[model samples]
Target: MSTIKLLVTGSTPVTVTTQKVLVARLGDEQSSHLLTFVAGGRSIIVKQTAVRTGTVVVVVSGSPGLIDAELRKAVAKAMVIRSTGR
Candidate 1:
């Protein structure tokens, strides 16, 4: 099995930050696990988890623009593998 990266865009800009914080907080409460990174001008957050499949699921729970941008990105990513030989 390999690590599967999943990005869950929250309902709002604050939500995204909050969720990430929450995840970190909970993780801290337990043990050190997983990794998170923030990137892009929109402040997109990337979360990596160990999974068996290559499917990347993006949960939308943020501002419309942010959510839309994520959806577009997801579609574009998914399309690439389908559109080209990968």
Candidate 2:
């Protein structure tokens, strides 16, 4: 997929290794977000609307080390944004 948009909790960690994807929390294994890694090719023009509360997306892009720290910070900020109505 050239683009992938997934609706996952702010708690999900961004994992980028040999594969690029997101990891869902325990017991929520069926989340397709966990399997999305293709940023090169597949589908196009996909759009999503949360339609839910306390749902925010924090995207961190860069090297693995950078992404780890950035994602943590971003997610924290996103949580605040969600809680305060953003």
Candidate 3:
């Protein structure tokens, strides 16, 4: 799996541990995937598109540390979903 190294574009280092959550919704009419994170005590959601067959969506919700680790986990879960032809 690849890593997401977000670099700062401005001066002065800004350190923040963002929490992320993965969600997968499948219904008879439509399917959707989402990645939600927390910043400043607020919840941020990142919707995923272009999902193909056998794609898995995982949800990681918790503190920054937990979310950080779950990011990798989400990818791994996705791979598994693909393998299972879900």
The top-ranked prediction according to lDDT is 3
Residue 59 C-alpha lDDT in model 1: 35
Residue 17 in candidate 2, Cα distance off native in Å? 11
lDDT of 2 by residue, 1-86 (tens): 33334434574443322333443331212111212333334422211111122345444444444444454455666677777887
For candidate 3, write residues 1-86 as lDDT tens digits: 12233435564333334232333333112223444544345645544332233434444344445444455556566777667877
- Which ten-residue region of model 2 has the weakest summed lDDT? 44-53
Off by over 4 Å in 2: 1-18, 21-54
Model 3 weakest lDDT span, ten residues long: 23-32
Q: What is the lDDT of residue 33 in candidate 1?
A: 24
Error of 1 at 15 (Å): 19
**RMSD for each of the candidates:** 14.1, 12.5, 12.1
TM-score-based ranking: 2, 3, 1
Residue 50's lDDT within candidate 3 is 28
Q: If the candidates were sorted by their lDDT against the true structure, best first, what order would they fall in?
A: 3, 2, 1
Local distance difference test scores for all models:
0.36, 0.38, 0.43
**Pairwise lDDT winner, candidates 1 and 3:** 3
